[model samples]
Every structure is written in C-alpha cells, then in structure tokens.
Target chain A: MERETILSVRDLDVKFSLRGRKLNALRGVSLDLYKGESLAIVGESGSGKSVFVKTFMGLLDANGWIDGGSITYKGEDLTKYTTEKQWLGIRGKEIAMVLQDPMTSLNPLKTIGAQIIEAIELHQNLHGEAARKEMLSVLTDVGITEPERRAKQYPHEFSGGMRQRVVIAIAVACRPQVLICDEPTTALDVTIQAQILHLIRDLKEKYNLTTVYITHDLGVVANVADRIAVMYAGDIVEIGLCEEVFYEPKHPYTWALLSSLPQLGVKGEPLYSIHGTPPNLFYEVKGDAFAPRNPQALKIDFVKRPPYFDVSPTHKARTWLLDPRAPKIDPPEAVRKLATEGVKGYA
Target chain B: MPENENREVLLSVRDMSVCFGKGKRIFKAVNNVSFDIFKGETFGLVGESGSGKTTIGRAIIRINPTTSGDVIFKGQKINGKISKELDRRVTREIQMIFQDPMASLNERAKVDYIVSEGLYSGERISEEERKRRVEKALQEVGLLPEFASRFPHEFSGGQRQRIGVARALIMQPDFIIADEPISALDVSIRAQVLNLLSELQKERGLTYLFISHDLSVMRFICDRIAVIHKGVLVELAETEKLFAHPLHPYTRALLSAIPLPDPVREKNKVLEVYDPTQHDYSVDKPSWVEIEEGHMVWGNEKELNRYRDMLKA
Candidate 1:
C-alpha cells in the first residue's frame, strides 16, 4: 500500500558557527512523513532531533543556517521560502508546533481562550462571534471543561495539564495537516502525560494529520509511534517499523537504547545506561558517529561510515555489524529478555 | 514514646502543618505531616505538584516558617520563633539543595564564594582552611578545583547542580533535604548525579530527605518511602515493599503511572490517574494505622477494612 507523502526531507544539513567553529547540527538527514502516521525521532540530547524540526517551522536562531537541503511540503520547497510572509501563511495553519514548555509558548498576559482564538482567526477567516464559537468548540474538543469560563482564564490560572491541553487546542485550531510536538509531555506528571499522549493520538486520528513526535523518552515513543527513527550525533543511524526496531534491532546504538529502559517486570538489576557521552558535533566525523560509544565497533566502522543495510522490507540500520562480511553479534541478555516479554510485536 | 529512646533517629517531624493565607480563606499546604528520617538512611517523599513535599523540605531547613509543628533534630525542637543559637544549630545540622540550581545559586557569586558561604556563617576560619574545604568539596562533586573562580552561568546545568551539592555538603550537615535535585538535569547527567549522591551519602553517613516526583529514581536511592497526596501523608513503607506490593490505592496508581523504559511494558500498561473522590474519607477523624510491620497507612478502620476487602476480592 502506497501512502500519500505529506512531507519529504532530503539531505538536510544545519550548521552553527559557534566561537569561530562550525558545528554541524544535522548532517544529510533524510526522511519522509506520510499523512496520518506518527513518526518518532528518538535520541539523547544534542542529537539534532530538535534542530531538524525547528528548521521546518523557521524557528531556528540566527546563528543556524541550512547549508544544503530541501524540505518539500506538498511539492513546495520550504527551505527556499525564507520570507516572513510565506512562513506566516504556512505556520500555525498548514503546520503547527507545540514546544516543550507550555508556559513559554503561551502568552502570559492573554487568556487561554483568547490566545487560541487569535490563532484560529489568524489562520482561518473566523471573526468576532464566529471565532468565539470556534474557540469554544476547539477547547471542548481538547477535553477542557467549562469552555465558556475557561476562555476568560489566563495561562497561570490553569494547571500544567490544562495548560498543555490549551496548547493542543491552539495547535489543532486551524486543522493543520501536520503537528510537530517536541517533548510536549516531558515536564508533566505521568498521569497527566498519559492523558496528553491519548489526547494527541485521538486528535491525530480525528483530523487525519501526520505527527512528528520528538523525545528522549522511549516509553513515550513506544505507545504512540508507528515508525521510529534512531538518531545519533547528527545522523539517522536506523529507521524501521516500531515492532522490528524494538524486537530485532540491528544497530548497536538502538540495542543500547532498549537496554537502558526501566521496565515494570524486570527486577534483577538496575537499568543499564549507555556509557560515555555523545560525540561533539563541532568536529567532523570520518566514519560512524556512534563508533566511539559502540562496544562492538569494527575497524571499518571507524574508517568509513557504513551504508544503510536492509534488515527487512521495512527496517534498515547504518552500522558495520549489519554487513554480510561482519561478525555476528547479539544484544545483551537484559535487552533480549525485555524484547521477548515487553516490546515484541509492538507494531 | 520516650524522648531519648533511640540514637538512630536523626530527625523527627511531629504534627507538621503549614497554612497559607489566614482566617476563613486559609489553605492548609501541609496537614499534620509527621515522619522520621533515620541516620545513614535515605527517606524518599514522593508526591505530585500540590502535595506539599517541597513545603516540608523547606520547613525542615527553616526556609519558611511552619504554622504548627516541631522539627526535632537530635531530640530538640527547632520551630516557632527560633533563636539565633537554634538557627545556627539548625543551619549547621540541616542543609537544602533546591530543584533549579540556576535559580537557587547566586549568578554573580563565584564558585569559591558559593561553596564557602555555608562555612562562612559557622565560625571564624582561616583563609587556608576555607580554600582547602572549597577545593575538597568541588573535587568530591567531580568539578575541577580551578572552577572555584568561575560564576554559576559559566557552568552547564549538570555542573551547576554539582556546585549546588558542593555548597550544601561543605557545611557537613547531618541531614540534607534535596528537593527534586536532578529533575532539571539532562537524562545522561542524571545517573552521574545520583551515583555521586549515593557515594557521598555512604562516605559521610548522611541522612537525606530526598523529595522528588520521580518514583524510579527514588526506588534506586531511597531506603524508605513516604507517599504524600494533596496535603496529607497517604502511605509510608520500606522502598522494596512499597515497590513490590503497594498497599494504598494512591501509591499503586502512582507506581503504575511511572513510564517504564521498556517499549513492551509501556504499551501493555495502562496508567490510571489518582481520583480522591473514589475513596471514602467520610470519617470525622482519621489517623495513621500500622497495616503491617514498618508499613503505615492513613485512614479510619472502616475505610481500611473496606480497602482490605476490596483488595481480597
């Protein structure tokens, strides 16, 4: 089945000149987003997951520049459209984004309802009574009670969960084709996090919108992601169906990520964390970015970057271990047990 | 209970209650919260936003005044219009590490001054002694000795937290209250800080009132667990027992809510929110009752019996 592609990114490269040194934030990262499918980009901090998404929304700081890449949305090149007028039409209308901190994204002076209504009016041609009516409907749809009164309430008046809900209401107010959520529930409590995830999932289905969820927490990605992209340093090391990625991971970095997850039933020992910090992006890498941290790194892995080796029809990983000539290796016992019990058949 | 019964009791808080505002519109932030932190043991306080865990931590260090309650340290009450002598004693014995290191630490103050601030108040000490203590504290937290001259803004989130810990530990406090110390840190740096805290606790025989919303981190570090909801102490039990078999419904709900790292368990598990309305708190008076050895739950006998029956079913 060939799904219609909503957005296609090719050879996206972002670099920052910090203290006279050029730091490559995103290096030749390419991916496709189909309509109504949720894609999760998983990595530790400084993996450029946030940078890639920020580029799409034109929210990157002045120091960052796209050296080479094309982000095509509906066959239109987004990188070339650098004018504020072009961005104003696309942002918060065709595509909306929700940031990690709800408080910062929301206006402190304005009421929650008023802020959402502003977004509605800016994108959609709703005005006065019509905008108010639509704002109430959107608030109610996002599971917020007393839409009439809450419309008058400010951001500080609502709890963390309620504020996030208001943020969601505003994001979805214009019926955006894509929602870029960057760690939307990271700061929230677990119960509230669950509600937010459920709300995002429900809204995605109701509106038939594509979603790009960026987060460090694999637990969040497991429940929501249809496909997962394992990013390291500034590159996508692996991309696969969620089930295959969780069950039979080919990349050593992906295996490490799986083992580090703390599970409910596993009781023998503490969760294993990936030792050593991620490599500095300021320096250029000759080979694999994860080779320094990967315990099973081969000589070829250090000298030359491995091409994406196909593991299955839907799975591919960038590692020398996936090569036919390379020595076979197995994931740690803890990860295997977790895969068998918890993560297998995730798709 | 006898006053001088056990030397193992490092800090005891009795009937601690704190209220904001006054008169008819008063809000009880903390209600009759009483718990003991043993010497050389980590006491975990887990709760949500409005649970008053932070308030309890603040009250113990005298950062804020308690409405009514005795914060007893080494068998002496230190609360309600404290004297300078008592304040000095409390400051020496108890220290606090705040959640946001950037906000807690003075941006303009150099690392040397920040670390020496605690020792500065104690007694007159030579410059050589101060330098030695500051260097030792910084080294203990894995920071460079030369960093003592740098300001807080120069350091990363993790390094700033290490500075915060160094500042608190230089006083050599018997009991330390860490209020969500690692919540602001990066995930990779979190384990490093936790390991450092654990190592420090073992070396110094320090008692910690570790307050955080993270159950997994608490499970790893804390010896005993106390669950607070709203303004009430809901449950208190040993860490292993609490994680293994949570008795209180709220505790169970909280435990289930922790998002496990495993994708499989994460998918299969359904975390339920804690609803106070479901429980019957109709009893005119409620008290803490021992459900088992070393496990205490707050509720009336009728409610306990009902809960027990429900669990059995």
Candidate 2:
C-alpha cells in the first residue's frame, strides 16, 4: 500500500549573505515525509541538515533567504506564506518542532503549565479551568508523574531530560500532523537519551504523525528512523530504507559515516573517522562537494556532480562511483566487518 | 594491556573526597574516588553529568580543595591549601584542557599569547625564543605555524581544540586532565583530535586523565577505565577487561547503553539499567575494594549484603 506524503520538499535552496559573501546553506535539496513514518536527515554539522528542516518550521534566521524551491505540506505551498501570522496557525498547531536545547527553547519565567496551557489555548477556544485540565493531561500523557505539580514548576526546576519531555509534550499538545525534532537528545545522557528516543517513537505512534528527525548520530538514525536521508554540503547525497542504507550503503560518504560510528564488541580497533572537514559553502563549485574528501573520487567526479543513481527501487545515492562505467570500489575492511558482524539482520 | 609495561606511576589519586558547603547540609561532590595514571598512558574516567568526574579531575590538580584524602603525584601530596612552592610545582607538573575550547581560551588573545601565557612566569626569555616555542607547540598539535597570528574566532572548533591542546603542551606538564575535550567537536573531527591526542601522548610521554561520558571513545584511547556514579567510583579495571566483563551493575549498564553502528543488533540489544543496590556493601563504610589486580569496586560488606539481598528478589 502506498503511504500518503505529509510533506514534500522540491529543489529547496536556502542562501545567506554575510560580509558581501553569498553562502549556499541548502542547495537544491529535496525529500519526502510520509504519514506515520520517521525520515531521519543525518549529517555532520555544516552539512546543511538543520537549514533544510528549518524552512519547514519557519525558524530560519533573518540573514537566511529562500532562494528557490517549494515546500508543500498537504498539497499547500508553505513557501508562499510570507508572514508569521499565517505561519503561526501551522507552526505549533499543524507542524510543531522540538529544538536541540530544551533549556533555551523554553521560557524560564513561565511555568510549564502556563506555557503548555497557552499553547493549547492558542489553537483552541478553551479558557482557564478547561485549558489547565487539558495541559495536565498532556503532561501526564508524556510520562511526567504528578502532572499537576510538574505543570506548576518552572523550566529550571526540571532536569535536562524532563525539560525535553515537557517540550515533547507541548509539541504533541495540538496533535500536530508533523513533528520535527532537531537533535532533541544530543545534550542528554545515554540512559536518558534512550528514554527520550523511546518517548518520541511512542508519541509518533500514538499521534499517528509524520516525523522528521535531524541529527548527526547515525546510531540514533539506525534505531528510530524508518528511512534515512544522508546530507552533505547542503545536498541529499543518499536516501533509502534504514536497513538498505545501513547494511548496503553504496555512497562512500555513507560508508564513511557508518564506519565512523564507535561500536560495542569491536575491541581495540580504532574507529574510522572521515578525513578532512566539510567544504565551505561560500564558494560556488563545479563537480561534487564531497569529491575532494572522497577517497574513491574519479575524473568524472572532479569534472561534474553525479546524478542520483538508483541502487534499488527505494534506495538511491548521488555518486560518480555509482555509474555503471565507473569501477566498483569495495568499502574498507573494518566497515565490511562492521556491516556483517555488528549490523546483522539490517539488510 | 601491552602499554601497561614500562608505565611509570605519574599520578595517584587515593581515597579522594570533596564535599561542597559544610555541616550536615554538605553535598559530597566526590566521594572516595581513587585511580592511578601511569606516565605515557591515557586513563579514562567515564560517567554522566553530576557523576563527580570533573570534581575528581579538579581535586587532583588542586583547583578545588579536597575535603578529605590525598592526590599524590610522583611522591608529593597535591590537595588542601596550596603553598607558593606547591602551586608552582603542581602547575608545572599538571595542565588541563576544558570541554569548550572557545570559552576556555581567551577570545581576544592571539594564538601565540595564549600558548605562551604559561611560560610568562618562567625566567625572561627572548621574544624570538618564545615565538619559536609557541610555533613548535602549535606544530606539535597538527595546527599550522601561521595560526599563531590568528585569533580564537578565526579557527574552526577542531582547530580551536588543537590550540587548547597546544596551550597545555606548551607548559610541558607531565600529566594532563582532559575534561570531555572532544565532546564539543564534530563527529568527523572527533577522531582526528583523538588520534592527535594519542600520537602526542606517544611522542611526548605525557600521562592523561581522559574524562568523557561516551564509552566508545573511552575504549579507544584509555589504557584503564574508571566508572563513577553519583559521587562514587563504582568500578575501575583495564579498558579491555572492563568492556569485556563489566562486574559492577552500573558498569554493565553503561556498556549496554553504547549505541552500536549496526541497525539490527541495536534493536535486539536491550541495555539493562545500572542498579547500585544490587551489590553487598552495608557492613562497613563505603569504599573501593580491590576485587582483583588493579580492579576496584565500591561498597563494603553492609552495603554489599543489602545489594545481594535485593538481587535475590
């Protein structure tokens, strides 16, 4: 059965001009988010992952300008909406977001209850007692105990993990069709991080909402995402089912990302890290942005950017190495072992 | 374990405890934590926030006065009130690299000034000689020599960390406490910095108290592992042994929580939470006991009995 696409982004381009230098933050990036499924956008910082998703929530900085492309939500072009007033209706109601830092995202002055109730009241005509009731229930639903007491407490009173849970509660308050989480658990501890990941997954199921989870950790993507979108230098280099992407990654960059992750049970062997920093987005470039750092770069890779070559019906990667004419290069030995031993049952 | 041979005992933290405030209202930040770092070996301290890992590091360097116990480096005790002589010796022998490189370093200072600040207290050296030393330190950390002229903001996060390392190395300290040094770096750059630290430790014979929450990282660089939780050192063992057969409940839980790269195995592997009450330690005061050679576990008979009883349920 074909799933309904909740959000479809096409040829999306976001640019910034600083000190008379134009930088392309997102260059012709496109992907789809289906209802009731998670699409994880994975990449290192400065890979333009955040910038591409920020467009959905209308959270781009003042310097950022959408140069081209359209973001369609439920067949409506969100890019066409120019004002915050129009976006406010959808921002927290239809398309809610959970930012990286819960401390910064929440207002310290306001009580959690007040803030949550305010969120609920904005979309609904509930007032006073009724709004408070809804807010407490939402808090309880997100796994916070003693919802009444917790709702009255300020953001500072809660731990990093609890505050993030509160933020998730507020995001899910309106039953938004889409929830965008931007590195939601990056600052949290591993145990707390696992709980939060489970919470997000549970909430996604309960609400039957489409989720766009953006993070640098491939370990996170492997656990939570239904499909994976590998981004590099403001472009979607690869996109596939989670199993296919993890086990049979065709792109050298994806292979590098997979291999770079530190694994348990892999004793003594040094974890492989992708060499060289991500390229500066300021300069206009021909060929691939990843070619210079790619160990298996060919003459064609240097001359022009590779088109999206299909590996399977659902999996594709933008790499010259994917070309039928290009010579096939195997992944590093350690990575091969990691895929077979560590990543069993994925493919 | 091969690196354990020829390892000189550089720093030894014995029964160190640090308490904040006073009287009955006092909070024990570091409760009887103990470990040893041999010369030219990297000893990792792994724990989550509020685990008192940082307090242990600071106490060893005498940044914070220990409430009780001692931090012995070489043979001299380094804790409590610092005298002028002790301060000079401790500062010269030990250095620190903080988590946030940009915030730890002076933003306004040039790279050379930051690196040479430690040498300012030494006998007056020629400006040319100082510049040479600064450039040499930068080169050692894999940064370009010309970076000396640039400010902190000009460099990337990874470069700034290299600068921080260079600053510490310029002091030529025998032991260095790196508190989550690479936690702030990008995933791709983290390996570079780790490799750089590993190589520098080999070339310079520097001992490191490498502290981090990430177990995968700890496994790579550390020779021995110390697991702390809620102001107590729960487990200490050789890095490989600790990873292979983690005895303590917390250590086992910590090992289980490390996310594997493999998608399928990650789903199947259920990480058990660390329950401290499962071990017997109620008969005597809580302290680390040597279960085997170089391996320590916290709790005495009284607490251990309680834990054993709980496990029986």
Candidate 3:
C-alpha cells in the first residue's frame, strides 16, 4: 500500500546537558511513519530510541533540547515547538504517547472515566454529556467490557491488563493521528501482553492510527511492526520493511541483535551474547559507534563514519560492510539460515 | 531407566500448599504442589506473576512457611520449625538467589561482606580463610578480585547479579533456588549470566530450582519443567517433551503466547488464548494425573482421556 507519510523526521539530532558536558543522544536519525502502519524503534538502553519519540511529541526533558533536525508532522515542524500553548496543541491532540508502565502514566486519584473525558474534552470539542459518551465509546472500543461500570472505578480497581486498556483508551480518546507506544507490554504478563498486542492492532485498524512502537522485544516487533528501525548508539543503523530487516538484514549490528534472541529452541547450544558495552555517550562518538563491538569491523570502520547504503529500494543500513569496496562477508551461520530458508517464509 | 530416575533425588516436594490471610480473605497462593528435582538438574517452575511459582521457591527454603505438606531434601523431611542443628544442616544444603540483586544486597555494605554473609552465622573460619572463600565464590560467578572493595552501587546490573550468585555460592550448597536471576538483566547480559550459571552448575554439580516467568529462558536451561496457573500445578514433564506435546490448556496457551525470535514464525503465529471457563472442571475435581511416562497433567478423568486421545491421534 502506497500510503501517505503521516510524520516525516529528517536529520534529527537531540542532546542533553548533563553536568558540564553536552551528550548527543540522537544523531542524524530519520524515519517516515506511514498512515495506519506500525514502525518499531528497537534498541538497548541509552540507544536514544525513547529520545527520538520524545522529540516528535515535544516531550523532551528540560535539560535536553533539540540540537538540530526537523520532525515534520502535518504542516508544522515539531522542533520549533516550545511554549505550553504549542505543545498542548500537538501533545495529546496530534500525537499521544503510551509509556511502559500504566501506573505512572495514569492519575491514581482520578477515575479512569474522568481522565479519558478530560483528554477528549481538551482535544475534541465535546462537552459534558457528549464528552462522557465519547469517552465511554472509546473505552469500549479499546476492548474494555462494561464501560459504564469501569468508568466509575479507579485505576487501582482494574488489573494491570485493564489499566493498560484504560491507558490506551485515554491515548485514543482524542483520536490522535499517531500513537507512540514505548515498551507498553514489557511490564505485563506474556498472556496479557498478547491480548494488549491484539487490542493495539485492532485499534490501529479501527482508528487508522499511525503507530510508532519503541521496544527491544523483536518478537513483538515482528507481530505489530510494518517496518522496523534498528537503533544502536543513538543511530538508526538499519531501517526497512519488517520482512527486509528480518530476512535480508544488511547491518552487522542487526545480525548480532537477531542472533542474541533466546527463543530459537536450540537446546543446550551456547546462546550468542553481543560482546562489549554500548559506546559511552559522554564523549564524542567517532566513526561507527558499533565498530568496537563489531567482530567484522574493518580498519575504515574506525576512521570514517559509514553512510546509509541501500540494500533494496526500501532497505538501508549504516555499516562499513555495506559499502561496495568492503570485503564480502556473510552474517553468522544462524543468521544466514534465517535470511534464506527462514521463518520469514511463514506468517 | 533414564539417568534422572537412577540418580539420587536431590529435593522432593509433597502436596505443598502456601496460603495467605485468614477467613474470607484467605488465598491459597500455592495449592498442593508436588514435584521432584534430581541431582545436577535444572528444575523449572514456570508461571506468570502472582501465580505462586515464586511462593513455591520461597516455601521450599522455609522463608514463607508452607501451610501444609512436607518438603524432603536428601530423603529427610525438612519443613516448619526445626532444631537449630537441623536448621544449620538445611542452611548448608540449600541456598537462594533472589530476583532483584539491588534490593537483595545491602546498598551500604561492600561486595566482600555481602558475598560472605552466609559464613558469618555458624562457621568459625579465620579472616584469611573467609577472604579466600569469598574471593573464590566471586571468581566462580565471573567477578574480579578488585570488585570486593566496591559498594553495590558501583557495579552494573549483571555484575550485581553475579554478586548475588556469589552470595549464594558462599555456602557451596548442593541445591540453589534461583528466582528469576536473569529476568532483570538486558538481553546481552542475560546470555552472559546464563552461561555463567550453567558453567557454575556443571562445575559444582549443583541442583537448581529455577523459577521464572520467561518460558523461552526456561526452555534454554531447564531439564524438566512444571507449569503453574492460579497456584495449581497444571503440567510437569521434561523440557523437550513439554514443548513438543503440551496437554493442559494453560500450558498450550502459555506456549503459543511466547513470542519467538524468528520474525517469520512470530508474524504467522496463531496465539492460543487460554480461558479457564473453556474447561468443564465443575463435574469432577481436578488433580495431578500421570498422562504419559514422565509427564503429568492437572485435570479430571474426562480431560485426561481427551489428552490421551489427542496424544494417540
């Protein structure tokens, strides 16, 4: 489907003023989220996956500010957004964020109904009776049965799964164009997680939500993401369609991440662990940030930064190995088999 | 006979139940759970949070008192209040590694003191001997000698977990109750910790009552597994057999719910949602029944026959 890009991020750079030093959290990160498609931003802690989304929503902390780049949503550039007036217009009305923990995201004192109604009234022009109706409808739409009764109950009355549903209900109350979920299911049980994933997928179709999912769980990514953005060290090392990134991965970092997954069922076989820690963000990053951990790192990888090389028309990777002049080296045997005769052939 | 059957039974739990609160508020967190761990094997207790898997681990170590049933370690029943001599014997034979290393380790204490906490109780070792044992325990968990002086805050999550492992290893216990040791660590760190654990187990010939919500990790490490749901033992079998042929509805649902690393399989997967209402358990009381050789399922006569037919088919 050739859908219109709902949000187009370009040359995005974000930094935080920690202590006396300026730490670059996101560098040259770009992504184009399409209408009614889920884009997953995957990375470890401090990889700037959260920072990238926070920038688009104008939710970046006080110490941190956008260094450069533009996040073009609708006709507005989100980078220029500052004042409470501008952020209020965009934050929940245009783009809504669902964090990992629902407890912190929700107001414990207020009832779930009040929160949803408040969000709806703030964004849409619904008032009193109409607002209550809209809020209840949204609550039901997010698969919360008996919306009337649930609305009267506090967040504490609901289970973790139900609370998350209420959180989703609140996110969709304003009927935002984009829904940004940051590890929403990491804290939930696996069974509950499946239900939540199903709920989100249903909501995406029902509301035509352009969803940007920030998670480290590749399995969850495979199920929901139409496209996958593999982030490493404040950089999007690879970005492509879910199929392209999984089956025909071009970046060595993507390969390592894929191989490190524990669900392969290769019993008793020593599982692969990615060597070395992520580059310290305190100092200036030279060349490829992953080059130190890259087993197939070339001499040029240390000296020069690799540009995004095209694997396919839709797929690109930022690794020296992707360069035409670089030596021909295949990913590990497991990853090679995954790229070729792999489960990508299945669902 | 398999080697497990012939080998000495390390720990055997008989109809153990753990309940909390009183009267109307009474809740049985673990209900009549029975399972056995053989020598030098990883016995996994798989369940979701609040399912009482953690409670079972705690009950075996006598941390949370078991309301009913007996716990036999090395053919001797050890449950409830016992003599100090018996308590010391139990303490020496078993040790526990908690889920959160940060919370379990005292933030104010140094690494060496935390690791050698078990020794301070009964053992009358000299300062030199204590230092040597602590260092050896730290080394076994893949920590450095230099780490002994630093406080808990100084080490990373995985390193802190290693310290937790070192604390447990200080006693050199035959059995270790590892309660979700690697769940908190990052993926890369998880593998490193798991490898370290497996290496330590092999080196010491250790028996682990490995408890975790992550079935994927359980499959990677456990020799045998028992699935728990709402404080009841739903299924028990060898890891490979359990994965291949899950009999209970809960076990099947749990398996299908586990997202695989493979994108293709994950994308095409049909997730099985297990609902308790789907089963007709009102007619006959459900209990643990051996459905196949070395495989147990918690079900009534009707469910067992259905499971048997399903297996035959």
Candidate 4:
C-alpha cells in the first residue's frame, strides 16, 4: 500500500547547553512519519527518543535548540518556528502530547471536566456549554463510565488508570491531527497498560490521527505500533515494519535490545545485557556511538560511521555488518530464533 | 521446586493481615493472606498497585505491623513484642531492597556509610574490616570498589540500584524481600540486576520473597508464583503450572492482559476483563482450597467444582 508522508525530518540535530558544555542530544537523525501510522521509537533514557518528538511541537527545554536540518510538516519548515506565538498554531491543533506521568500532567485544583474544556476552548474554538458538552463527550470517548459524575471529580479522586484516561481525554479534546504519547503506560499496571494501549489505538482510528509512541519498553509497543525505530546514542540505528525489526533485525544494537528481553530468557541462564553505558553527549561521538558497548562491533565501526543500508523496500538499518565486505557474524541465539521461528520460539 | 516433604519451608505466613488507620477510617491493606516460601527458591507475589503485594513484603520485614495472624520464619513467630535477642537476629537475617533506587538511597551520604549502616546496629566491627566488607559487597554487585566513597547522586539509575543491592547483601541476610526491585530500571539494566540477584542467590542459598507487578519477569525468575488482588491471594502454584492452568478469573484476566512481545500473537489475542460482581458471594462465602496438589485457588464450593472440571478438560 502506498502511503503519504505526513511529516519529514532530515539530518535533524538537537543540542542542549548543560553546565556551559554543548551536549548533542540528537545527532543527524532523519525519518518520515507516514499519515495515520503508529510509529514507535524505542530506546533507553537519554537516547534522544523524547527529544526527537519534542522538536515536533517546539517543546524543547529553554537551554536546548535545534542546531541544524529541517522538520517539514504541511508544507512548512517547523525548525523556523522561533516564537511561542508561531508555535501555538502548530502545538495543539496540529500536534498534541500525552506525557508519561498522569499525576503531574493534570491540575489537582481543577475538575477533570474543566481541564478538558479548557483544551477544547483554546484549540477547538468552543466556549461555555458547548465546550462543556465537548468535554463530556471526550470523557465518554475515553471509556470513562460516568461522564457526568467523573467530570466533577478532582484528579486525586481517580486511580492511576483513570487519571491516564483523563490525560488522554485532554489531548484528544484538542482534536489534533497527530498525537504523541510519551511512555503513556510506563507508570501504570500491566492490566491497565493493556487497556490504555487499546484505548489509544481506538482513538487513533476514530479520529484518523497519526500516532507516535515513545517508550523504553519494547514489549509494550509490539502490538500497537505499525512501524518500529530503534534509537541509540541520539541516532536511529534501525527503522522498519514492526515484524521486520523484531524478526529480521540487522543492527547489533537492535539484536541486543531484542535479546535482552526477559521473555526470551531461559530459566537457568543469564539474560543478554549491554555491558557499558551510553556515550556521553558532551563529547564528540566517533564512528558508531554504540560500538564501544556492542560485543559484535566490527573493526571499522570504531573508525567511521556506517550509513543506512536498505534491507528491504520498507526496512533500513545503519551497521557495518550490512556491508558486503564485512565478515559474517551471527546475532545472539535468541535473535536467530526470532528470525527463523518468529516470536513463537520464545513463547 | 523439590517435593514439599523434602524441601524445608524457609518462611511461612499464616493468616497474615495488615491494617492501617483505626475506627471508622480503618483500612485493611492485606486481608488474611497465607503462603509458604521454600528454601533456596524465589517465591513471587504478582499483583497490581494497591493489591497489597508491597504491603505484604513490608509486613514480612517488620516495616508494617500486622493486626492479626502470624509470620513464622524458621518455626518462630517474629512479629509484635519479640525478645531482644530474637529482634537482633531478625534484623540481621532479613533485609529488604526497596524500589526506586533514586529515592531509597541517601543522596547526602556516601555509599560506604549507607551500606555499613546495618552492620553498626548488630555487632561492632573495626573501620578497616567494615571497609573491606563494603568493597566485597560492591564487587559482588558488579560495581567498582572506589564507588563506595562517592554519593548516590554520582551514579546512574542502574549503578544506584546496584548500590542498593550491595547495601542489602552486606548484611548477609538469609531471606531478601525485594519490592519491585527492577521496575525503576531501564530494560537492558534490568537484565543485569536480575542476573546479579540470581547469581547471588545461587552462591548464598538465599530465599527471596520477590514482589512485583510484572508477570513476564516473574515467570523467568520465580519458582512458584501467587496471584494477589485487592489484598487477597486468588491463586498459588508453580510458575509454569499457574501459567498453564489459571483457576481464578482474576488470574486469567491478568495473564490475558500481559502484552506479548510477538505482534501477530498480540494482535490475535483476546483480553479478559474480570468483574468482582460475577461471584455471588453474598450467600456462599469464599475460601482458599487446594484444588490439586500444590495448586491452590480461592473460590466457593460451586466455583471450585467448576474449576476442577475445567482443569480436567
């Protein structure tokens, strides 16, 4: 199926000034967000997955700035948005964000209904009873049992799962074309996490909104995401269809990430783990940033950076192992089984 | 796990209940829970937040007072008004590793002091011997010995968590109560900590009461697992047995809710929502029963009979 690109990012570089030192949070990252597709960016903390999406809504910190490249959406260069006034036009109506912690996301002072109405009035141009009506509908849309009574309650009265639903309601109230959920289910329980994921997918279909999920947990996004992007050291090491990334992963980092899952582990053996920490962004990264920690790193991986190699028409990875001249190396045993027998091998 | 008769029961909680507040505002966090953890095995307690899994762990470690029932560790009741010698023994033999390493450790104090804090309470040791023990603990948890001098703010999340483990291991505890130990860690880092814990268990023959909400990790590490909901244990069986035959509705619901790593299987999976109102317990009260050998479930007589037939089928 041919799909249209909703947003295109090219060689985007984001840097933060921390304690008088330049930190390269995002280093020459590029990707395309397709219309109405759910793309998941998987990485550990400080891997720049959050920073990458923060650029879309101009949500970068005061000390952080876009150093280079462009973010093109709806025939406009988003990187050129300098003022909050200019960004206000694209922030909520075009793109909305649901943050990780629902406890801090909502106002404890105000009622849940009033908060959703505020978003509707600010973005949807509705007011008074109409805005209130829209807020109630949004609450009902998010699976709240009693919309009328729940609207009158404060955030403290709701459970963690319920509070997350309110946060989603507020985001959905803006009626944005694209919705970004940053670790939406990390703070929630397993049963509630599954329900919230299902709610997000349903909301996406109902509104025809393109969705982006940013999480460190790969298991949480397997069922929800249509595509997967593996990020390491502020770079997109691999991007592919969900099945391709899980089954036929090429990057050693991707293999390590897949093999590190506890679900793929044997009872008596140690689970696969990355040995060292991520490279410090304050210093210049040489060649591949993940090479120092990657056990299967090729010799040249430390000298020169690898370019994106096409594994298929829809899948691409950045690794020296993909080069024809590189020696053959096998991924971990678990990852090999993922390729041969799919996720069933571990199951 | 070995046969029940052959293996020794390391810790047994009989009708344990933990309550909070008093009078009309009273709350029972754990209501009449009972289980036995065998020696040299990881006993898992799986439940959601507010399910009293953490509360049970706290009660075992004497952080929370139990209003009723008893906690017997090696054939001795170790709760409420114990003797001074027994108190000292309990303090030394049982240690807890708290969740959220970022908050568990003292930010102002150096790692050396935080780890040796327990040692000072029991027996007095020379400063040189304390330092040596600290170094050994750090090395066992895969941290550099030099890190003992640095404050917790200097370490990353995983490193700080390792410090927490070192602090617990330094006590040479026989049983460890780990409360959501790896939940605050990154995915790759969780593997490292889990491997360290299992290795330490093998070397020391430690029994662990592992309390967590993540079932996937529990399946990997736990020998026997118990499913708890709203302070009540609904099922208890070996890890594989519980997964294969979930007799309780809540257990089945939780199992169905776990997001599989496989996309195709996940997409095809059907979710089960458990409703408490499904059981007409107003007339027929519920009780814990061993429906099969070593497999327990909480249900009334009618529901227990139905479960037996389902298990057979």
**Per-candidate TM-score against the hidden true structure:** 0.92, 0.94, 0.97, 0.98
Q: Tell me the tens digit of each residue's lDDT in model 2 across A1-347.
A: 58788889999999998988999999898887888889999998888898888898788899989999999987789888899898887887889899999989999999999989888888666889998998988898889999988888999999999999999988988779899999999989987888898889888888888889999887788778889999999999999998889888888888777666555224444557777788888987568888888877888878898889999988999988889899979977656776676642211
Cα deviation of B224 in candidate 1 (Å)?
Answer: 2.0
Clashing pairs in model 1, backbone N/Cα/C closer than 3 A: A342-B264, A343-B264
Docking class of 3: medium
DockQ of each: 0.30, 0.45, 0.56, 0.65
**Model 1 residue A36 lDDT?**
85
Model 2's chain B yields a TM-score of: 0.92
Name the TM-score of candidate 4: 0.98
lDDT of 3 by residue, B197-259 (tens): 888888889999999999888888999999999999999999888988888989999988887
The ten-residue window of minimal lDDT in model 4 chain B covers B259-268
DockQ for model 2?
A: 0.45
Docking class of 1: acceptable
Give the C-alpha interface root-mean-square deviation per candidate.
5.2, 4.5, 3.2, 2.4
CA-lDDT, candidates in order: 0.84, 0.84, 0.87, 0.92
Chain B TM-scores, listed for every candidate in order, come to 0.94, 0.92, 0.97, 0.99
* Candidate ordering by DockQ (highest first): 4, 3, 2, 1
Off by over 4 Å in 4: A342-347
Per-model TM-score (chain A alone)? 0.96, 0.95, 0.96, 0.97
What is the Cα-based lDDT of residue B125 in candidate 4? 93
The recovered share of true contacts, given per candidate in order, is: 0.28, 0.48, 0.56, 0.71
Pairs that collide in candidate 4 are: none
